[model samples]
Target: MTVYQLPVEVTAFARWLTELAGRLRPDAGWYGVFAARDPEGLRACFDGAEILPWDVVESLLQDAGEPADGPLADRARALYAAAATAHDRRPGGAGALAERRDLMERERRYAESRARELGERLRAATGEAEAAGLENDLAWVRDDHARAAARVTELTTRLARVEGHARAEPVPAAQAEPAAAPARTQTPVRTPAPPAPARPARARPRGARYAWLEESAEERAPVAVPVLPTGGAAPRGARFGGGGDSAEAGGPARVAEAADPAEAARAAANAVYALQRLRAQGRSGEAHVLLCEALNGPPDRLPALAAELHRAGLGADWSTLLWEAASLPPGRLAAVAGVLADAGRAADCDQLLRQGVARPVEELAGACAALHAEAHHREAHALLTAFVRVRAPEDAARLAGADPRGLVPQLLDAARAVSATRERDLLHALRVAGLAGA
Candidate 1:
């Protein structure tokens, strides 16, 4: 028995065949082995797998009985047709189409304008020879214009057909196959995979406090955020320590130890700003990891750092970072939660509330209001109800006091659902105050 290694594409094709046929076939295994040795040869045998040349694949699928008219068959036929068309147009088809359309339009306009100029010249000719010459030139211009217009029309029709096929529903397999297959004489050009582009160095202004915040002239750099090690420790050499010092002792550490809090805050702010730039450049995952470093650093500077992030339009990214960290200090948790809620990420805000319920009531009130204002009534109801159930009656009362729009009825419903008598009683007091419906 001849052993054969299958390429990834051939394996995928076999899987697609199995799905379409609703049963595995021995031939699929053979095809997989056959494809591994000669993908180009297999493609040739199938007469170009680009369009509807599915004669070979379809024969294997039909072995298990013609596939029932279902989503599987419909999708397979449609995907096959699309794959063929895409393969045929792989050489900058979209860009080429646009450029051709523009060129034809310009040519048509120029020809029309030239014909008009020649017509005017023909009228001004003083002799029959000049008049005849001008008329000939005008005729040539008119013919060119006509040809350009016709070519434009042909291209427009072709483009419409291609676009229509793309948008059309998948055809049945029986209807999908061509009545007569076209000859496949041309060999496909195997374009080499392009190398990854390097990130360009960005120029920064002198004395700029947060140079990373300035938009770079080059394409955004791809930054992979390093995952925190187990036990939630900051990565080695991460500069998140207080007094602008990294925990790892070094020259910068020696200098940071002597720096004032103001200088430390500025350094920390710049680091956070760099994370923001990463987020802006579509590297949110990496930025999130770097942001977690801040959480492990100085807890005291979190509010100021979060505020800076908020000002830079990265409130959503910061919310995600804070939520992922899940170990923020109570003060920083409340501050970040408020920012998240204000930014309309009520889900993250709710999680924060659940984690930091021990924080001062005053600090939690803004987030609660933001949730309520955004009509995240369910989350707000649950958070408040949980607080009422877990905290003392006075703390729950203070929470109720913050509810100017009267969420007592919603809280009562939540309390009743959970069978919490204390929460029910607390809501009843607010209901008695006419803040809730009877």
Candidate 2:
């Protein structure tokens, strides 16, 4: 039929499709073309609506009324008979049908296989992120973007090479000159050899006293605290091994040898510092692994040491590991919330915040705002509300009055809500407490 002769409904469908094409994905485009109202679109259609085979039509009828069971089980018996006859007439008809069935089965199997492969890769990547100290959820997203960009670059290069090869004109037999060259008279047309393989990169060597983080903490490094002699005398080092001259000499220490407690503590502290450096560099997973290695066993003051590690940016890893280790008790919620907030795992951070704020009442308003901007509003609200109630009650009250929607507004409102006298008193009390303790 001529273009103008088409029905109005068909014309509208065509225009709707033309507009939709810009937004529709490639996988879904085929179906769109199948239902197009234009002449060109109609020509390109699958034409399978009335071509349902006998078995499919019968199945369709048998499964009718359950639309999701699919059209295969909903067609009439007469439609099946027509399909059966048409299907039987095609070249190698029965064989082709069998082949098609096999192909579909194989495709499904391959799809399942690919899904399993992806799952494995995701799990491994997650482990690597944990190991490498990527405790923050945002870090995972950043890494994912980086990896995807690299893949795109690699694919683009490969495509360029393929296109170059495809467009190159071939030399015809009449123009070819290879056979014309004389074996003895001519220097051999030598082809350049492929480049040699690059040598494997070497790993960094570990020192004898490498400070390790706890596996449970997933910390990048051990916390190191410096200690000076309480006696106010500059001793070269402390004596171990029954506090005798033999211990102070630092010679071949015997089985009964014991390290100076202060020296050991210093070593642990230094290890923690190194771990802090790694965490700053976005290698928290490696830092955590290293920290565990350094400690070698349960240290006496782990929680305090962990707090120090958290200060070093290994907190996110520490919190994640701790929660996993202790059956995720309520007490650890506050710590986990803090770490997750830093790592920018806003969604997970929100969940942890909900669990944490009930007891400790430490609200992560900043975290809530961040996640909210990222479209995790439900979580952000939960976190921000809880945070205001616990850490900044005045601010929370102000927020409650203003009903601020965003991060800064929420923060400001919360601040304004607090009474000036109360704020001054709280600050003074904290300062005095620090002074008295010191």
Candidate 3:
């Protein structure tokens, strides 16, 4: 059933349980009661009223839905303990006398309504097995409630200390005496503090100059040095070898090459290539670590590193890296979409796609097919019109192959001669290969 088809009573009950859970523990709000997946199980969770894994709660609800009989069944019992703990901590009123009265009347009525709902659901379970499962779930909910009680007690004690401190503080006599003073004098206007001096701009560091070189796509800058005559001149592409000692004083002379920004970027990109090679050797985790280090090194080199990663088919990881880059701005979300699209994660790509992305229509058409191949037909249909509007007839037909009926007839109608026949046969082959599952 669709998510909206969930019973109204279930939604209302879940909302109350979620609110109660939130009040008891602030962090619990991150998980909603609907995540539990079972209406009766949620009621049991509310009844027990403590912190519990959302998944376990869902399992209990599943058990409750069928013939309940398992270790997972006693949710109602567990929920009872949680509810008792929550009920104890909730304020009755301003004073103990009022609190007692309110708890007895108002709180009791609310609890009775919620409990009545629970009872009706419990009575509806058909078989002995289902009842047994429900019983087990209730028991687990109780256990969770017991564990949460100690934590709640500690929090209540701390809150009491804070409240006591607030109450014990005495009001200054000067404030009380001011009631008789003139209206203008009641608020003593103090002179405003002078604004602090603006900080001097920081001088750019020397290393920052090298940073541009690391990221630049520019050609090499010329360097002047004395050239030695090695049998008239050195041969083209000849290697020059030297040890570390050669560069020191009184040692062998060192050859100095001109600085090249493009070469440096290429070298840095090559380092990413080395990491990718590691991935090809079944060391993906290590390659990811290395990519992270390279990307983190400097702002300028990051694009080069990202490009290399994309080329290596580490597009998914690269998207995550781009997301984590502090130096990068939010405009990079398009780049993220591109990477996700390339990785065939169309649903994920959809979250980051924005207006004005530089990506063309054909790319999106391909993405539609990828999503369709993944059995996400709804998403594919959403992009189909856009694909036809932008791409060539053949490209659009290929994307439309992902349609429920397949694209053979459409391809045949659009094409001529051998091309149409080839496409028709390809469609049949795709069907035979079971790529289109029944």
Candidate 4:
């Protein structure tokens, strides 16, 4: 059935129930009757009502294409009977208690089934890694099962208490009344209030930059440094020395000023590498600090740093870094796109390339050529076609010369799709110039 039809069916069933209850008992509203909390109150309502059996209710629900059995069916029957009883001003009695027991039983059975499935998976787990992953799932399932079992026990006890209460003999009306009390008076006593405890001194603010200094001695201890395995190249930002920007120029000065520059740089590289490994291992909190440090280090180097993070499987941070470095230089953007494409992020690479097309035609052509060389022909083709379509005819004529894969035929096809115009004439001219079908 379609999604829209299901709600209509449910509404129809509810309306039918309301009308049926009104016909049976006109004084009480359906909701007022069903909303009774106590078994005695509900039983009072059901006293003279002719309630339908569970099977009848189930068949009715099935006819309406709704679930006909289990907790849902029990609850539906309980509500219908309660509404009728409330209208008739009769007791609901044992009906409410019976529905509660059925609901709890169904819940317990579902929980047990879930626990069994999880236990089977846990038993079949092959190694420490697999077992560790399933540990939380198994624990949750077992806990739910235990709670369901405990609830079932509690419900059973309550059901017995309710049954016993129902079977008990009624007290005599005269005996149920309380005896008259004698009048008396007494003076009130005064008491003192307790004093509040004094507040302690406030500590200094510990910012993220110096958070390491606040760590305990054991946490601050030196550890073995990890090197990137053979075939895993360090990201561009990990390089120690560089030229061009002010950050690169000051790198040497910063290193020279440090007592142990080599060690410091090595530590930084190690930290970056470690963060990458931690992210791969799903230790996000530990990696977050290092990610912040890398991001806040140098604006010029952020893109390359982000590219490395992306390669290292820190996708969430990589996306943040990309947004931060959105206005990067054309060359840097192209480089970042290459890194993303190499890391199997073709969509990101294509997006970055589209942004790079806003640069000069020569730069755009070079980027397109690189994209083609990297076997991203589809992206390259789309980028060039969009560039031509948006540019003026004269501008497009100049840009078309740089089209490595002759897109002139595609342009002609586009031209034919539109009404004849100057743009179409320009495309025809370009086609005759051997650039269209090349």
Candidate 5:
């Protein structure tokens, strides 16, 4: 059963809940309409589809197909909290929590793999705007991956702790260790090759001792990993990292790095993923040493690495790389400056802009506007000194006329001081502009 959008005039919120309960009725018989493996073709089926990880809000919203926004969407809006808390008080066993933990681990690994793919794209990106956007997306993917990793760790560690407590006797470390997987090192991307769904180790009702561990992924709060739209958009000729597995596997996982981006991007992505995985595993010393090695390549490699770092949200490392690349030719400086200005790094941005900028006059204005939008001291001043140099007399007149953010005044002041220097010509243009405006 499905209710695409709740009726607009529906008064009580309980009506919406009634429909949701119907749609998500727990597995009762042989057929599971609401199951992760919906047999009736009523839901979107992908690999590793479980009955429902109600804790994963994205899966619910997607399967529920509820209109999330607009006037018609108002009634279903209450489900966000309800659905996130669905499993909070549900009963389960040790094996169930362990299964959920394994699911989370699979999801975390999938997210990291996706981050690598995004980093690969960042490598091939050339335009600063394109690179900046790719980097931004990569950063989002990275953050999401971190959240998934945390959830996995949380589930893994908590279940172990509680299970150990419930044990009748002390189990040997070698025989009864927690379900924590070893620290994930950089390895080839593995596509999940889940076979027929049979009861794997975690599927049994081993004990009800860890039922308390059945708390909703959201209830245990550090923020549950929102399932991203890593939907069925598999890469050509092969499935990418996200799909194709989220269940107990019957055979060896398939290696799947062939669909990744080309050489430059692939290498850049590999380094980034390795560093992040190492750091997440608490191998900071290894990550640091690896990072140093990655950064030690020729100067030409700095920009790509820096861009990738930025995309990965490694701000400190990104900043360092950017500074290191500062000595390179200024071909891409203007574009980089545009991004920096948008990021509120006006001083650094302007320095790059002033060193030399090759972008069109119009783009410069846009960059200045971006900077001004970010900060203004009586007026928006980005690489205005550079701006005045390339600006046409008409533009000079225009800028001098309004002096939005007092830009002309600042330029005029600077020109007054630099008149005896090489840029003294700027003083004459400002004068011409000021006279023309008058």
Candidate 6:
């Protein structure tokens, strides 16, 4: 419970768990799972993540024989005993539940028989006064019978539901029930519902485009790569549209177009909030596609969409959004990045500045060149400046490994005709990154 106690508990617990797993027979129905898992790997997972491995303990309580005979065996048995006592104390413990069901059945049967006997007595009564007394007694018995029958039915249905669910899936490893539950109640503690199997993560997503996603991959289920929605695949009336006339016509458009952009951004939070839910539900593939389309959509919509997503919170997904945001045109790109910063995504902005993740070197050069040819000096400087400031060494190294891709000339050309004063800071950062001169 205290920080000082954690290290000791985790080490001992992992050993006890492994020992129990190793001792489990094939008949215990848990040998296959333990055999498949590397003991060291399992121990490492426990140590690194402080999650109480209630699922493991529950399985051991259910089917694992016990700790193998050794020094740890005594400690393991003590733990099992404490947990077993708690388990039985819970309102719906295995043994207690059976006993309660039996008691309820007997109560129901007795109530029904008493009601039937009282009814017969009422029917046999001769005098009006006697018949009235007998009828009153019969009515009370009937009510008791009905109440008992209902209670029995409810208990039976609840038990059946719990058993059916237990068969369908094992408890989630993250179920929060402590070894000692906080409260015990008559209402049964329902089993933790297991999630459905997820699609396997794709090999390709761990490459360049999705490299940033790998940082905390161990903390979550492997997210599968998303298949971008095609024209036909797009929801016909999807509230969150990607761009253009269709965006203007969609439900989300009305919200984004509100008189108060801030108010609209707050309201539009649900769009990204839904994406968060999808990922939490292990539908990361869908979440990935939705994010790319929304954040990197039409230039006109980028600021509002970015605001909405930032408002809803991206959890540990800043990299994904910045990757998608990288493809935005220079002006829209800067605007969206600022919105992310203002909405408390300053850390994400820092990542952009450092990594320039998903920065397409050739694409940026061409876009900046087009701006310069049009005599938009400041804008050209802004574009290149943004890229240089986000000095991703990996990207530069990637360029170095294969081809220069006109890096020097691209920087030179972008700097020409630009207002020195207006773009001074950008030029300095660019120079610092060795991509340009003062």
Identify the candidate with maximal lDDT: 1
lDDT of 3 by residue, 1-438 (tens): 634232333333344445544444322332343434445644554543323433344433453352232212222222322333233334531243233333333433443444455456668989898877766665545444432332233233223323443344444656544554355456343333486676554543323223323223222221111121111121111011111111122311111222344754675566666665764453433444454444323333444555565776766556445323311111122233333455565644443332111123323333333344445454444334232322234443443434424443433333333256554554554465443332
lDDT of 6: 0.43
Clash number by candidate, in order: 2, 28, 32, 16, 4, 0
- The full ranking of all candidates by TM-score, starting with the best, is 6, 4, 1, 5, 3, 2
Cα lDDT for residue 174, candidate 2: 51
RMSD of each: 24.4, 30.6, 24.8, 26.5, 26.1, 25.1
TM-score of 6: 0.27
Runs with alpha carbons beyond 4 Å of true place in candidate 3 = 1-260, 326-438
Q: Mind giving the per-residue lDDT tens digits that candidate 5 earns over 168-276?
A: 2334545443444578444333343576564333432222112112233232322111111111111111111122222232211111112222443555666777778
**lDDT (tens digit, per residue) of candidate 4 on 1-438:** 643222322333355454444444333333333334233533332342233323334444554445532334433533443333232222454566457657755765676777778778889999998888788877766655544444444344334434444334344555454464566433222222365565554453343333223233333222111121221121111111111232222211111111243433443445557766764553443454455444223222333444555665655556434432222332233344554555566756554443333334544544444445446565566555444443335544555565525544444444444436845776666765656555
Candidate 5 lDDT: 0.42
Cα lDDT computed for each candidate against the true fold = 0.47, 0.36, 0.38, 0.43, 0.42, 0.43
Which portions of model 6 show Cα errors greater than 4 Å?
Answer: 1-267, 296-313, 327-360, 370-438
Say which prediction, candidate 3 or candidate 5, comes out ahead on TM-score.
Answer: 5
Ranking by lDDT: 1, 4, 6, 5, 3, 2
lDDT tens per residue, model 1, 193-216 = 487687667675332233223234
Per-residue accuracy of model 2 over 204-308 as CA lDDT, tens digit each:
344423432222333222221112112111111111101112224332111112334464465556767776676456443355455444323333223444555
In model 5, the runs with Cα more than 4 Å from the true position are 1-348, 376-382, 388-405, 420-424, 431-438
Off by over 4 Å in 2: 1-209, 212-265, 280-285, 323-438
lDDT of 6 by residue, 254-359 (tens): 1112125553454346456667676555344455556554543222343455555555565334445564454443333444444444456554544443223223
Each prediction's TM-score against the native? 0.25, 0.19, 0.20, 0.26, 0.23, 0.27
